[model samples]
Target: MTEVQTLEAPSARRPSASKAPRTTKSTANLGEGFAARVLSVLSEHQRIALRLRHGEGLSPEQVAARMKLPQGVTDRLLADAERTLQAARRAFVEALVENAASRD
Candidate 1:
């Protein structure tokens, strides 16, 4: 009768992309947090609208001329920016809820 001996071998594990850590440069925040991330992903027109109207406090007419956008279009752009920010806020809240749930 022959006796068989079992040998243990080390298991090789590969690191997952999801498990990789993000560097600071790749994950810079323009605003406070996730809310900022959502808000920052705006179209050029939307960003210009925000910069002119809020950042520089420019008049509608001036902003329209400087940005080469119609006055009515600039108004719409401002409204769009507001809408984008509100939507971003909702998304941020949802993300927080999801993250919290995952932790639990």
Candidate 2:
């Protein structure tokens, strides 16, 4: 009888726990932090506009009626608030990226 040859597979190695990347906080935490910072920078009118339109889920016309302001005025306030929020979001993202890059 011919001799049989067998080969054994090598054992897999587990990644070291200390070498794994660590996560600081969840996205929800980051979002809440960003929101708090944005709120700190927003004007009273802008905060009120955001609360009425987003928190209360009111239509632009409804917001205008509730505030007793003209549709045009409400529209302007909403637009300005939206712009402020966009700028803040961009700044926040840029700062986060910069921080991560610095860490790396």
Candidate 3:
């Protein structure tokens, strides 16, 4: 799942990707924590949508067919999943900052 996510998630790309610069150990740790959190919040359907769409690098139409959903619904589902992930990411960063600040 982590490998699949790295395929399309540019911001959360794995350090092994040639296009992305090598990530520091601490940065990678933080990203892992965030990814775990995001996965925990996602529904089973949403996770499947993301894995099919981004992980497989499939088109909306293809994802729809595989998911047995209408193309429009697939598109909307993908969008919603992305929005959820973004929100979770923001919260994760905020929490990290708060933790650091409190420790200081």
Model 2: how far residue 87 lies from native, Å: 0.5
Whole-model lDDT, model 2: 0.75
**Could you tell me every candidate's TM-score relative to the true structure?**
0.54, 0.67, 0.64
Q: Which of the predicted structures, 1 or 2, would earn the higher lDDT when compared with the native?
A: 2
lDDT of each: 0.68, 0.75, 0.77
Per-residue accuracy of model 3 over 1-104 as CA lDDT, tens digit each: 42423346556645557754345798679889779878878777788888997788888899999999898888888888888887876787688678667966
The number of clashing residue pairs in model 1 is 0
Worst window of 10 by summed lDDT in candidate 1: 1-10
Report the Cα lDDT for residue 13, model 3: 40
Q: Point out the worst 10-residue segment of candidate 3 by lDDT.
A: 1-10
Model 3, backbone clash pairs (residues 3+ apart or across chains), number: 0
RMSD of each candidate relative to the true structure: 20.7, 18.5, 7.0
Q: With candidate 3 superimposed using the best TM-score fit, by how many Å does residue 54's alpha carbon deviate from the native?
A: 1.3
Tens digits of per-residue lDDT for model 2, 1-104? 01113465678565688965455677558867777877777777777877898888899999899988999988898888778777877887797778777978
lDDT of 2 at 41: 78
Candidate 2 deviant stretches above 4 angstroms: 1-23, 26-34
Q: Which pairs in model 2 have colliding backbones? A: none
TM-score of 2: 0.67
